[model samples]
Each structure stands twice: as structure tokens, then as C-alpha cells.
Target chain A: MTLRANNIEHFYGSEHILHNISLEIMPKKITAIIGESGSGKTTLLAILSSLLKPTRGTIYYDDILLSNIKNIDLFRKKNIGFVFQFHYLIDYLTLKENIALGALKESDNIEELIKTLGISNLANRYGNEVSGGERQRAAIARALVNSPSFVFADEPTGNLDTKNAIGVFELFRNFKDTSFIVATHDKKIIDYADIIIEMEDGYVKNISSQRT
Target chain B: MITPLKALRKNKFKTALIFFSMVVAISAIFLISAISNGIVGMYSTMLKTDGDIIVTQRGIADTFFSDINYTIKKRIEKISNVKEVNALILGAAPVDNLPIVGIYGVSENRFDSYKLISGIYPKSNEVIMGQKIYKMLNSPKKIVISKKEFNVSGVFKSKIGFEDGGVVMRLDDGSKIFHKSTSIFLVSLKDIESKNTITDINHLNSDIEAKTTDNFIDNYNQFKIIKTSSDVISALAFLMGVLGIVSMMSMVVNDRKVEFGIMRSVGLPSKTIIIKLVAETIIIAIFAYIFALALSYIVLEIIQNTQKFQGYINGEITFSLGALIFFTSVLMAIVGTLLPAIWASRVDPMSLILRGAY
Candidate 1:
């Protein structure tokens, strides 16, 4: 539940993406990782969420280091979920089936989840057939289907208007037991997050806490 | 696995192309291999006769062209363990417009192998036409060989391709027409287990060679060449099949790298992804192979019915041959899917997202 990164640095070829970055994400709390374009927010999110291994340093879920866990995919399958800026749903799959892909068991309540995401009428529709806002909501539903402890979102609202963007953030707040790490450039996230980690040029410039 | 099938169904065009490629590859392999198997089967059936050993003159490329004194049969009969000696005169003579009709001349008692369908065995100066050749030539009352006319006394059928496609006559008539002492001497041993009799008979004359029918069929230069060619051709066809699958699967996986990346990000294990791809390939491969089998059967039926291939082959795919084809096809399918799955698994998951659909 508590996610920790220690001196995580990454590079793509000769270019450095993230400097020595370290942070702790509290359990059941909303954490926002904010930075300008090309500031390495997505890269850091990628490393922490097990999408990519860091070039240097470590990430830990509670006390267990990432390298110590043998099957990373299975580990992620059970405890972690991911949502991307593009609402990366398989175009060939129906909306309900796409969400069910993340479900680890038959008892994950797919119908209720679809209703919660307010995509019940579009459950049988192909991923490509839904509106952008509805697709993002379905994406969020997918990330929560397995009741994973942590859900990582990278620019989930980049293409959305103010109302849709707010709707997306509201879903994150409503999912009570699931911790969310959102990497974005949106200023609106600051009002909803319990912790704010602002990044500049791949370095963690500031870490602030705000709770209602 | 079900999701992958759904995906294939969704992209029906791509799936169909892969399916067609697989079908063509498998069908080509089975059809060519069947021809190869047919040659061996034909020879084996032809040689299953009462005579256990064959004696022909040394240094001959064409077995029927070999010549030795017919009197050598008496000397060979006198050898220890030699039960009987039968002299045979063999040659090829053109009939009507058909070139190279095989001709067989045997001693009086050697006609048991022929199934007499319509008439008795041939007498001196007379000929019994093979059933197929008789019907094919429209049942002529007389035929010509070496400018000599012989009355067609009866019709007989022998499943052996060379015999069924030609004519049989008495040894005296054949010797006079062919102008040779004899082409071959077939020997039957008292005890078939007596292997030394062949060597002893071989030493009797310097100009002639004797070998057991099994040894001759296996070691004959021409038969060896056919076997080797069949093996090489079948192996090459299977290799090309594997390569075709590899190429098709490579394109499929390459095109879906982003999709795989998303799947991985959603926590689908690389092993599961691999299993799915292999499963999909096997389904297509099995279906294609079954379809190819049906196609091959239709082609074989046409060959069996056609005038060109009658008596040459039975147009059969044996049990072992079918199983060999099936296993090779499945192996090709698995190998083809595995390579691409491995490449997809190693691809950076987030890189696909950042660089692709994002």
C-alpha cells in the first residue's frame, strides 16, 4: 500500500529521462506528480508502476523491493493497475470485456463496475465506439476491476475538457480504498490530491502534503 | 486464448491470408510426399513374386537390356540349394502410337503371377495382352513387335505397372524377336534363408551377377536415387513450410506490438501471451492441414482415374505418412508462433505506449 522509490534514475539511449528521484506515496491517498511537458513525469510514473524498470535504483511496495519479487507481471496483476492518457483499450474488445481483462476473478462484479463507471449502456460497444470521456471512465473502471491496492494514471485527462477532466478526477476520489498516483500537467489535480510532488527537468522540485 | 481468437475473427482479412498460406504450404508437402511414397509402394508391390533372387548381366544401366546365355539357367539350377531356375527375356517395344511399351518373356511355368482374367497363358508364337493395355489399345486381334506379327491369344491382368502396361509372350518367341539370349534369370532357392547360394551362383559365371530380390530392390542405383530424391524434396518442402509460418507470424506480431504492450501493461503475463499466440497458430494450422488433406484427396482421385496414372500408383496416403505430415505441420506452427511471441515479450511496454497510441 505504501509505495516508495529510492534514487530512481532512468535513461533512453544517451538522454537522461529522470534524475535521482525519491518519494513515498501514502496508502489510500491521492498523489499527484505534476511537471511541464518533457519534464520526465511519465518516466517516473512508468518506473514506479512496473511498466518500465529504472536504469538505476529501486522501487518498493511496502518493504518488498521490486527486484526481490520474482514474477513482476503476476505481482502487478494482483496488486497494481494502470491507466494511460490515450485510454488504451484494445479496439477489438467490447467495453465490458476490456474492463474484465483486469479482473483476476469471476467475482470482481463486472456489471456493477460498468454501472459505477456509468458505461452500462455501452458495455457491449467496442472500445473504439465510445466517446472520449466514456472511454476514460471505462479505463478507470478497468484499473479498479481487480481491486488492486495501487492504480497509476499517466495524464488520464490530457484530451478532456474541464467538465470531463473533473469527472475523471472525481472517480479517483470516489474509489476509496485504491491509492492513485497521477502524473499530469493539470493544475486542477492540486485541489483533489492528498500529496503533491512537483517535478522540474526530471528532478523532484517540491513535495507537499494537503488533506481535507 | 479466447481473446486472441476474437481478435483474429475481428481482423478476418489478415487471419485469412495467414490461413491460406498455411494451407498451401501443408498441401504442397503432402502431395509431393505422396508421389514419393507411391513410387516405393509401386515397386514393392511389383516385386512381391515367387522368385526370391534375380540374376542379370553385370554393368547394365537398364535392367531389361541386360543379356546372358539362356543355357546359364541350367548351370544355375545345378548349384547347391538352387530349387529352380527360370530364364526371362525383357525388352520395350512400341505399340501403335504409344512409345516404349514394356515386354516380358517368361518360361512356360512362370505365368502363375498373372491373374488370368479372360483367357489362358500364352503359347509359343502367341501373346497375352495385359488387361489395361488390351482395353486401352481397343482389343486388337493382332499386334506387331520387331516387325513380327503375333496373335493376341488372351487377356490377363497383373497389378505391376510395367507388366500391366505391356505384353507377355513365350521365351522362344521373345528371344527370336529381341535377338538376345535372355535378359535375366530368376532363381528360387530351396531354403530362402540360404544367403550363400546367391554368392555361389554369382561365381559360376564371370559375365553375370546374382542378388536377392530384397537386396536388389534396396541397393539398386536407380531405386537409391529415387529414395534420396524423395527424402530431400520432402525435407525441403517441410522447411519451406516452417519458414512461411515464421514469416507470416512475424508480420502479425510486429503489427500488434502496441496491442501486446497494452496487454502487458494490463498485467497479462508474457508466458500467457506466448501461449495465446501458439494456441491461435495451432488452430489455424490444424484447420489448414485438414483442408489440405481434403484437397490432396481430390487430386489423388483425379490421378487414379486419369489414363496417365492408372496402375502407376494407388494414390494412397499411408498411416505413417499422414502422421509424419501432421506432426511436422504442428511443429512448424509452434516454432512460427514462439519466435514472434518472444520478440513481443522483450519489447519495452511503456515505450510502445509513449511512442504509439498516446
Candidate 2:
């Protein structure tokens, strides 16, 4: 399903964070939201994920008006996924349990996801015990565990080294059928995006479609 | 579940402090409740003597010190449903300069309930001393009755409060020794269903107060317990228990803010997170309860062995059914955790991700 944010305006208290932001995130494609610091890239992404309510305008997940849905949790859990810059894995849980949490239902293939993330050896380790790169991979595995229709990642590769960041970007690109909207300042990720949206001062500056 | 537990494990010192605080609070409640129950049980059992009806003089001020005339005893025996009526006289008497001996006037035939440990019922003006008091008086060679000496018949075991501190004698000898005409009466009813019999007896003599023995004993025991400072102790115990639960719950919830935030960001509802927290608190409380029981028993045992309280100071510790303590502690923990959990759930994922707080 295509994710659309139309003329969205967001405010925290009385301070406006995003103003008249509009964008469409296509299914089976990767969309990058690029902006300088304080450009409201994260705020815009949060509104799309339903983690933050927009003060004005509407969001539609395909034909469903997300703004009108009463139980955003059900919609978010069933269709939306999130990957944060820092992995917020539960420190008490093993990597496998942390990944499986996103699914909300236990599956034997949770170990397969851990293995695919090259974190098989770290499966039994606590979140705090793993390296940052391993933690990021585990975070990705967690986001994809539910096989959600869309994923919203806020600077997922921001904390990683060049090699680790490239690895994560490739992982994002490999999920061919799942749509992704990544908010970041990294130009390297812009090259891999099917669509690029630029933001300035909480407003969309430009939107471009890249020919693969 | 994993997230919260991990957070708890990571901050081992903080978690342990919170856990210990919870244990102390829960244990305090458990200990107080157990001791209160133990003391009440002991007193109630003492009041459950074999008599169905016990008659005491009306408006005599002090029932223990009131005198029931021998003629009145005969009159009570005439009432229907009253199979037998026995007069018992109780007073304080000095034993070997120790003001601890209780003097009892009992009939020879109905003295079997005393369960003579090493002596027979007094035959003549002889007297039987309680084992504890008998031992305390260094097992006196002879107990003087009506200024006449009689050999100590034997030590007897009694579960009654009056018997706990002294000796028993025949009513005739007791009256002459105390220089009083008559005292208390213990009446056994053949059938408790005959409530009208007591009313009729009361009507027959407005000056006489005839009551079901159970009610009399209950009232008497309740009066004694209230007078003996048990009520104050029980109230204080209950208050401490409530406070302990509240304190523990607040501490645990306050310490786990980030853990709760992690759970919320993963799509768990605020309610689900609360349930888990309450469940965890209950589990902790259960552990504390067991610990409290053990500790109370140890304390009671030490008190019994060292201080030697005459009343039931050390009985088995018992927790109330209906999961009252468990539910109360859990509820307190939930209330304690609620605000913090809500605040944690409301944390914006953007702030958490951008600030790298998680």
C-alpha cells in the first residue's frame, strides 16, 4: 500500500515543527527524506508512522485515512515498522527475543532472522553486550520480523561506520516488495533511493524520482 | 517482558534496592497480620469453654470480681435446657510473696476439663495448682485452705485464662478462704436451641444476667484483648503494612522508566505494560510474604522462649485467604507504577531516537 502525507503540519506545544509538508511513499520502493539539522525530517517521518499526530492535514495508508482511524496501534502494528538510529533492544532479552518482539507472535524462524542478520552467534547475548553494528542489524531484523507493508527508519545508519552503514543501506534496498521511508542527512543513502524528498525549515523543498 | 526484566537486570543495584524495599514493606504487613491473627486466635480459643450459658450478676461493675449467691445458683439450675449449673469463684491470692496466684472455686465432679497433669481433683478443702504457677511457686509442699493446710494434690493443666495463673479448690473451701458468700457460675445447656429459656430466666429475676456461654466468652475475651493493648498493636501493624506496599510500589515504578519506554515503542499498549508490572510486583510480594512468615515465627519463638508471655504469644503464623494481602500489595504496586508507566509510554519515539536516550 502507498503511504501518503498531505499538507501535514505538526507542532510540539505551541512551537511548530513541520509546516505544510506533503509527500507520497510508494510501495516496493525506498524513499529517502534528506534535510539539514532542524529541518523536521524526523518529525515528518514520525507523523507518517502515526507515532506523532499532525496538527493539520491528513495521512492515507492506501485507501484508509490514517488520520481517521481510532486505533492507530492496530494499524501501526499490522502495517508499519520503525527502525531508530540507536537500537532500543531490551537489555534483559536475548537478541532472538528482542527480534521476535516485533512479530508479537513467536516463530521458530526468529533464529533464521538472527542468522540472516549475521547475529546468530550473538543470539543469546544481551542487548548491552553486543557491538553497535550488531545491534543495528538486530534492530533491522526486529523491524522486519512482522513482514510489515511499510517501514519508517530514522537515521538507521547514522551511527554506523562507512562499511556498516553501506551494509545497512543494502539491507534496506534488498527488501524489494516492502516500502521504506528513511529520514537522514546522509547523501550516500540518497543514491540508493527510488524517490528523494528534500526538506528545509519544516517545508518540503523538492521531490524527485530517480531512474534505476 | 524481556525489556523490563533486562532493564531491571542491568541496573542490578537499583533493582535490588527496589526489590528489598518491596520485601520489607510486604514482610512488615505479613508479620503484623500473622501476629495479630495468632493473638486473636489464642484468646478466642480460651473463650470457647464447654459451658453453653454463663450467668453473671447484673450491673456488678467488674464481672470477675462480682459475687453470685449460692441461692441464685440453685435458682439457675431450675431453668429448662439447663442440664447442670456449677458456681466458680475466682480471685487473686498471694503465693510465696508473689502476687500471681489465681484462686478458683470449682466442683469436684466437673473438674475433669482441667486435665489434671499430675494430681487428682481436690476432695475436701484441698487445692490443685496450675503446672506453670505451681512450678513458679517452687512446687509448694502444701497449699493452705481456710487456714488449714492440705497436701498439694497435683499439678493440673488448664486452658482457661483464670487457670493460667493459679489453683483450683472446692467451692465450700474457696468461700471460707476468700471470706465471701458466693461468686461466678458456669452453666452448661443441654440444648442451645432453647434461647427462650435464658430470656425466661432473665425475666424471672431482673437482677440476674443470663447469657449464652459463647456470647459471654466472646464478649469477655474481646474485652480482655482490648484492654491488654492487642488492639493498638493490631492497628499499628495494619497501617505499617499499607505503607510498606505503597512505598515499595513507588520505588519500583520510579526506577524503571526507560524499560517502560522501550516496551511502548515496540507497540505494547500502556495497559499491557501495567499488567506485567503489577504481576511482577505480586510475584515479589509473594516472596516477601514467605519471608515474613518465616521471620515472624522466628520472632515469636524467641519471645516465647525468652520472655515467656502467659497468653498465646506464639502460635502458627497464618495468612488470610481470598488473596487479600497478595491483591493489596499488587494493587499498591499497580497504583505506584501507573503514572510512571503512562509517562514512559507517552515518550516520543523521535525524541528517544534523536537524543539516543534508549
Candidate 3:
């Protein structure tokens, strides 16, 4: 059982944003939706992530439809996680507390996860005291805290410098068993995806699969 | 709760700005209400100091304008439990640069109620001025009332504001000048039938009201007017305070839209967002109420010391009024956050990213 989007169409007050989108998200794989600004890639990611409902379509999580879930927030809490371009960490909270904010339930693996992300020491500092790369790493830790089945990221490395941008993609590469649907304009993201979805002007221009 | 508190702590300047606004607005509300209550209180105390049951014409806004025919005093004097009925006339006139001077016209027998500090009791057209008023006039030998000249015979002292800064004259002389009215009758209640005295006097005439000195302000028409106006203004002041809080809290929520978007994306429920906003706003309101209470005391002090309100209105310091302010402040905080919370919780995470919030 996996996620599927069927006959998805979206409009912004008569301005079409997405067109007849149908796709299946593979389990335990990295999928990149890459396009230029205004290409509607982020909107598609929003629809897939439960942050939005398409104008004409149904999203299915395995055998259950998204609409039938009744409590979208509860469903999202149980199975989904998200990271945005800017690491909107609450500045007053320490990085560790910020990560703990996303926990669906208490888990003993948090310390190990922080170590894996290479931010174990940085976790105790306030969010404002940390460097950009450190804060983004904390954001990533926050997203994975729940051990969700799907992690949706919208331009996760958009605010980073060149070195830190590469580091973010490397972090995604290390999480092979977690399904990631990342939307971005960065060409560097191409190397890390098991499947690449190319969007152009509210349409999917191409979808390519590469095991390598 | 910790998250909300931490958020407020981090935005120190903004939180302080919110607190200051609430304090000022709530203080204004407290002042208006207190002054109104105080004016009623001061007048009641002053009017009741030397009298037991006071009688005045019904529907008269001012005691000076209340007309109970001179002959009515005879009927009240005959009532059971009535020891003495003093005919007192109250009026105001301008003297020199001073705009308002209180004038009391009392019969010869009631002269003892006012202590004569110097000289003799007023004779015929002569008048005695209050020590405070005498000093302000630089010891004038004569004062004018209703454009009539009268000699100032002596200086007197009184605790009541009406008499402390006023003139006292013979009842006959006052009637000749003020004309066409008898202001009030002060009834001295005998111990045994004091309760029935007021009821007996009120039954004599439908045009006049008779109440114990303690309940005089409650029945006075002028006091009713003051009370009604203060209620309206206080309500408006509180509304403005609530609106101020709403505007400030809404802007705070707007500034955190990016953070709220992220919280929503991470599957934080709308309920949690509401709780945070409620917690933060209520905390601010509580602090504001405390500050406003202190500020109100200072404001009342300044008003009391000022020449304009010095003798008349002293702000009523009551536990019930303080409690009223506290409850209203909490209500203001809750109502102020309601809209912002809903808006924050419903924020579109995708729209925020596209709009450059994240």
C-alpha cells in the first residue's frame, strides 16, 4: 500500500495551477519534483502533503481516501512530516526542544537521531544562536522525529549556501528507508532522487526512474 | 503554555507594547467609573453628615432647584419621630475670578450645625463664608449672590464640600435672593420611630421624596444623571480597550504567520494554536490589569489634588470595582485573541511558502 493522487486539478480563483495530475509515490524512495518558479511544483506538493485539497481529485493513502479520514490533522499527525525552505524554528526554544515539538509520541530514539543528524551538541543552544546549516539540520531532525511514513519538503535547501545545500541533499540520501517527496528548483537535487518528476507550466513534462 | 510564554519573552518589545496599551486603556476605564462612583459617594457623605432624613422635591436635578413650598415643612415637623426640621437652601454663584461658590441658606436654628470660627452668626442680609472660601477671597467684607450685595459677618468651618467652600445665609434672605423655591428640609430622627419617619413624610406629598441621609444619593436625580453618563462612558472605554487588544494581538499573529504555517504543516492541531494564543493573551492581560490598578491610583491622586476636582469627586476605591476591572481584562484578552487564533490556525502552509513567508 502506498500514496496515490488521481485526476488532480487545481485552480487559484480561475487561474489554473495544476492540470490532470495522476501519480503514485513509491515507498522508501526519494522523489524530486523539480521546476522553475511559477511551474506549480510546490502547489502539487501541497496537494500531496494534505496541506491543501485539490479542486478536482482524490488522494488515497493505501486503501483509504484522504477525504474519508475525517480528521486531517490527526491523520497528518500519525503519518506525515514536513520541512520548508526557511527553518522556522521558534527562536526562544533550544534546538532540541524545537525538534521535540514535532514528536507524535515520546520516543527513546531522539538522542540517536540527533547524533545521526550530526547536531547532538548544537541541540542545547537556542535556535537564534545556531548557524543556518545547524538550524536546517534541526528542522530535518524535527521532521523525522515522528518517524513518519512520508516526509514532504518544499525547497528545503533554498536558503542555504552552496556547501550547506549539498549537505542537506546528503542528509536526504542517508534516509533511504524513508519516502521523501521534495519540491525544488535546484538542479543539484537531480543526483539524489530515485525518481524525478519534471513540471512545466502547471503540467508534468516528464517523470524519469533511475535506480542508481 | 511554556511555548506561549517563551514566545512572549522573546518578543519583549512587542509584548511590552501590548501590555502598555492595555494598561492605559484599562486605566481610563477605571478612572471614569471611579470618578462617577466617587462623586456620588462624596456628595452622599457630605449631605448626610449633620442630617438624618433629607427631603427634596421629586424630579429636580439640583437641590437648589427643588421647590417644596415653605408650608410643607410644617406638615413634616408634625410627623412622629421628627425632632427638628431645618429648611436648607443650596445654590451656586460666581465670586471674583472663581466660577463656582456653594451657597447654603439655613434657618437660624441650624446655625449650630455649622461651627462659627470667628465673629457672629449672620443677621438679616448678612452672611458667613466658609474659611476656605474666605481665604480664597482674601477676606472679603462682602460677597454678591444673585446680583445682590451682602455683608460677610464671620468665617466658619465644615467637612462637607458643599459647606467648606461656600457661603451661609439666613433662610429668609436666601429666599428673597434665590426666589420662588425652598431647596431641602433636613429631618432629625428621634430614636424610637426613626424608620417610620421617612415613610410618614413621603406619604404627605407625592411631589417630594423623603429618604434617610444614607440613601439620599441613591434617590437624587442629579446623582442618577452622573451615574448614567459614567456607565455609558465606562462601557465605551472598556470597548476601546478590548479593541486595542484585538488590533495588537491580530498584528502579532500576522507577524508570526510564517511560524504558524510551519506549525500547521507539522500537524500541530488548530486546538493547540488556539491554546497558545489564549495562553499568551491572558498572561498579558493579567499583567496589564495589575499595572492598570497601580496607574489608576496615581491618576485618582492627581485628580484629587487638582483644584477642579479637589473638593467634589474623590475616586471611589472599592474592591468590587477592582474586581470588575480584573474580570473585564480577562474577558478582553479572550475576545481579542479569538479571531487571530482562528486565522493563524487556518493559515495555508503552501500559500505562505509561495508568498515568501518561508
Best candidate, DockQ-wise? 3
Distance from true position, residue B72, model 3, in Å? 4.6
Model 2 has a clash total of: 2
Candidate DockQ values, in order, are 0.63, 0.39, 0.63
TM-score of chain B of 2: 0.76
Task: Estimate, for each residue in B53-153, the C-alpha lDDT of model 2 and write its tens digit.
Answer: 76677866455566767777677778777887777776666655564456777755457767888867787757788776676667887865444676778
lDDT of 3 by residue, B115-226 (tens): 8899889999899987777877788998877778899899888765557678899998888867745789888877734677888898999999887876776767788898
Name model 1 segments beyond 4 Å from true.
A91-93, A105-112, A119-125, A128-134, A159-164, A186-190, B57-62, B65-69, B72-90, B116-120, B124-159, B173-179, B184-212, B305-314, B352-358
**After superposing candidate 3, which stretches have Cα over 4 Å from the reference?**
A161-163, A173-177, B50-52, B58-61, B69-78, B83-86, B107-164, B167-177, B188-196, B203-208, B211-216, B356-358
- For all candidates in order, the CA lDDT equals 0.83, 0.69, 0.82
Residue B32, candidate 1: how far off, in angstroms?
2.0
Candidate 3 DockQ, CA atoms:
0.63
RMSD of each: 3.5, 4.4, 3.5
Better of 2 and 3 by lDDT: 3
CAPRI tier of model 2? acceptable
